[model samples]
Target: MKLKFGFEEFILVFSISMFFFGYMRIKFTFMVIKVTDYYLYSYGNKGLLYCSLGLIALFTYFIIKYISKNVNTTR
Candidate 1:
């Protein structure tokens, strides 16, 4: 059976997907930095990157959970 969704739900889903995409990209970047050799340790950049990833991860979790709970998909 086909299903329909409200505009608000669509926007929320879009936002959650975007956040997840960002988180994945950042994770990849960090992995590359850690694996690459011969480069000097960038402490400041590493610290900020870790902090930002944590913050974004937390936000993404909350956003998806809240959006899913709030959007009634039972049609």
Candidate 2:
């Protein structure tokens, strides 16, 4: 039998990437909160951090919504 890969698999992979980025963002946020001086010195401004996190989150949300819509249509 042949294996099939489609939208679900695509979403799964993309979701994993999103999760990894999200985790990194959270770790940086915690560092910023716990060690403001060092974190700021190392990472510069927080605006880029927040912006990247928001974009990743928004992309992931849209992917999830797309997956749900595809599933509903297939059924």
Candidate 3:
């Protein structure tokens, strides 16, 4: 069956991509920063980190819910 791609699908894909990108950015940031500079780096990008975490959480929740709903419906 051919599935129709719509706004919700687009959003889900976008969110998933953004989640990975944010994860990689945070990982790289931590990897590049020295232990001694951790506090300074965190302080400078506190808001950005928080926002990334928030998006990650939100995306995870929605993704899980979506997958669960699909699984239940398919069964």
Candidate 4:
């Protein structure tokens, strides 16, 4: 027997992975902030926080765009 993998499966896996990745990033940012006393006190911590936020925004945009495109194509 052979198993088939397609775009939908890829998107499902990608979305789940990104979710966990984003969650861990945010958690790590909080941990850093706590250790550093605040986000403003260090450039490295601030950069890490911003980078994670940017990644989250990008992920959201891509996921929405993909879903919208698929929805339009299906109709």
Best of the candidates, lDDT: 3
Give the TM-score comparing model 2 with the true structure, all chains together. 0.42
For model 1, how many clashes?
A: 0
Better of 1 and 4 by TM-score: 4
In candidate 3, which residue pairs get closer than 3 Å at backbone N, Cα or C atoms, i.e. clash?
none
How large is the C-alpha RMSD of every model relative to the true structure? 7.3, 5.9, 5.6, 6.0
Show how many residue pairs clash in every candidate, following the order shown: 0, 0, 0, 0
The list of candidate 1 runs beyond 4 A from truth reads 1-3, 34-75
Residues 1-75, model 1: lDDT tens digits: 667787655655665665566556556566675554534235435545555665565666678767888786753
lDDT of 3 by residue, 46-72 (tens): 545654765766677688788989999
Give the number of the best model, judged by TM-score.
3
Pairs that collide in candidate 1 are none
lDDT of 2 by residue, 19-47 (tens): 56655666676566656676654553354
What is the per-residue lDDT of model 4 for residues 1-75, given as tens digits with 9 covering 90 to 100?
677887655655665665556566666655664464454345445555555655665677678778989999999
Q: CA lDDT of 8 in candidate 1?
A: 54
66, model 2: CA deviation in Å?
Answer: 0.5
Report how far residue 15 has shifted in candidate 1, in Å: 0.5
TM-score of each: 0.41, 0.42, 0.48, 0.44
